[model samples]
Target: MIMSHLPYLISAYGITLLTVLALWLTTYRRFHQAKNKLDIMKKLNHET
Candidate 1:
């Protein structure tokens, strides 16, 4: 019964978890990069 489909279930859950984690890491990196760029731009503007 359920035992027959156990492997399929486990793989599906593993794929979904990996996708969510990759997306989170990408978003986190992009956010910090954008913040750093913004800070640099502000400093340049202040210098003028």
Candidate 2:
């Protein structure tokens, strides 16, 4: 049975989780940065 490979399975799942979390954080940061730039541009455009 797969029970014999329990350690390997757990490690695989852990690596996958960390990868997803890293990807989510990177995307979230980029989105906020882009939004801030856009807001600044909009404000400048309105002032002109």
Candidate 3:
């Protein structure tokens, strides 16, 4: 019955959610790091 499968469904959804969150956070962090690096490079170029 549906009730018997509830635990499996809940775990599957939870795992999927966590995976998406981890991927999002990783992408966000990398984007900021790349942006900072770009800014630093631009400043160096301007100084020269």
TM-score of each model, in listed order: 0.86, 0.87, 0.93
> Which tens-of-lDDT digit does each residue in 1-48 have in candidate 1?
999999999999999999999999999999999999999999999999
Ranking by lDDT: 3, 1, 2
Steric clash pairs (candidate 2): none
lDDT of the structure predicted as candidate 1? 0.99
lDDT of 2 by residue, 1-48 (tens): 789899999999999999999999999999999999999999999999
TM-score of 1: 0.86
Backbone clashes (count) for model 2: 0
Worst 10 residues of 1 by lDDT: 1-10
RMSD of each: 0.9, 1.1, 0.6
Q: Is candidate 1 or candidate 2 better by lDDT?
A: 1
- Our tally of clashes for model 1 stands at 0
Model 2 stretches with alpha carbons more than 4 Å out:
none
Q: What is the lDDT of candidate 3?
A: 1.00
Q: Pick the lDDT winner.
A: 3
Location of the lowest summed lDDT over 10 successive residues in candidate 3: 1-10
Candidate 3's residue-wise lDDT over 1-37, tens digit each?
A: 9999999999999999999999999999999999999
What are the per-model numbers of colliding residue pairs?
0, 0, 0
